[model samples]
Target: MARKLPSRTTSDDTKSARTRERILDSTAAVLSRKGYSETRLTDVAEEAELQSPAIYYYFKSREELIEEVMWAGIAHMREHVEGVLAALPPETSAMDRILAAAEAHLRFSLSVSSYTTAAIRNSGQMPERIRERHEAERAKYGRVWRKLFKDAADDGELRDGVDLLTVRMLVIGSLNWAAEWWTPRTSKIDNVVEQARQLISNGIAK
Candidate 1:
């Protein structure tokens, strides 16, 4: 007779998922501050308030644990972008969508500061799967800029001879880099939003 298999249920799966999430969250905190090279399983375990051996139950090694954390962070960023895309009104112009998307990106990045910081700093040490996931999310988000530029061009909103790709690079590069230095108390989000809107709307022409 074949050996009996363990039964999987909604409750069991949910519990397991929660535990995995707890480990990942703790791992992100450790990796974000100390980075992959300096981080250790003990650090993650301590941060999570779990025994070092407990970590092995979810991940085989520190590398795997870090990979999961990076994966979760990127997944979160993608979800934020997708949520913004979904919330947009169907009749809204692409330019409006772009502005809204920028605000959303800024809010999410700032709100999840530690996770974003960890993702950016430890991205190089992440596994191939994490890298691929990050690229996919980026490509999906890039479509928003492309669509906005195409619509703007169609509506004659852009200045003569303005390159759409250049505009995207300038705008997104600025927004992403803001996470590096923006302070919640001093550089408030509303101010950042307005400044970004002004920068993009003012056009990049010399």
Candidate 2:
């Protein structure tokens, strides 16, 4: 059999994909530093080391760019949490799974990934159409949490009278809030995770 090789179009497609990622990364950095209202395509282009007009080749408008950045952030967060859950041992208890998920959430939020930080801080400022698109991505992440909580409840790990939906909201709300106040200089991520785990376990565990 003859060896297969990538076509010229495939190579061009790879380059185009890389350029789009570069634009999104630059946009995330700008959004984190300048916020959504203040960030401009010029800033993204400068950060990406491309001409301002080049950004439009990948994204049609500022709204489209911001929306893509926000969607990427949410998707990244969801993947991180899912990876953590998947890595747990099959024998892991429901409480342990919840703790692992919480730790993963906190660690990602505190890391230098500006995409998630931008998403956390600026998502609400997006235009209604963009916001709706972002929310759809966010809802997928929410379902992951709901499943974890629902499993915990079914296993009798959660306290009576505790609603799984409310627990999901409260847990995610607390984790998201850490993006605002958490700093490596003032507090450690592990310590913060431990504290959160303890508080949650005490509240929800039977």
Candidate 3:
């Protein structure tokens, strides 16, 4: 099953900021549950409990709003994986870091927020401008994994002669797929993550 988004309000935040967040959050939910082609300003308005015109005050167009949510999603995932790696001990093996990141990525994809799921779901199908900008954000997220793969290579843990970019793509591509078919009733997120970690650990050896 899909995960519900958590509130992001703050004590000092303006009501406007909170409402904007609600709009973005609702849009992400719609984009994840419904495809981008099926989502509309009115659907978001109804979900956010606001007038359709109100959305214009926050975002210029549907593409612009969707772009923001997608960007936010990649940013969230990058920060999460980076934080998990940074918190590890200095002597933690590169392979261990990769496994830790695999767990983090799986959990984020399966159980964290709809923003990332929507980002994954709608990737490559956005407007040209939106796709370009989102691809830049994607490149940034890709760099995080590239570093993980590179570090493993430096440690002599990654398979020799394999391209880091290819490894990054395979790892991220496979993990991102969990968003498509995962349901809570079928398997727990932890089980899915564990299987992914083992696959990565072995696949890196292949």
Q: lDDT winner among the candidates?
A: 2
Residues 70-185, candidate 3: write the lDDT tens digits.
Answer: 88888888889889989999999888988999899889877888999999998966878777777888898888888888888988997768788877888889999999999999
How many clashes show up per model? 0, 0, 2
- What's the true lDDT of residue 8 in model 1? 75
- Looking at model 1, report the run of 10 residues with the lowest lDDT sum: 197-206
- What CA RMSD would candidate 3 show? 7.9
CA lDDT of 2 in candidate 1? 100
Q: Which whole-number lDDT from 0 to 100 does residue 36 have in model 1? A: 75
Q: Is candidate 1 or candidate 2 better by TM-score?
A: 2
Please provide TM-scores, in order, for all candidate models, with all chains considered together.
0.79, 0.90, 0.90
lDDT of 2 by residue, 1-206 (tens): 99988699999999999999999999998998888899999899999999999988888999999998898888899999999999999999988898999988888878857889889978778878788878999999999888888889889888899987777898889989888787789788788988999989998889
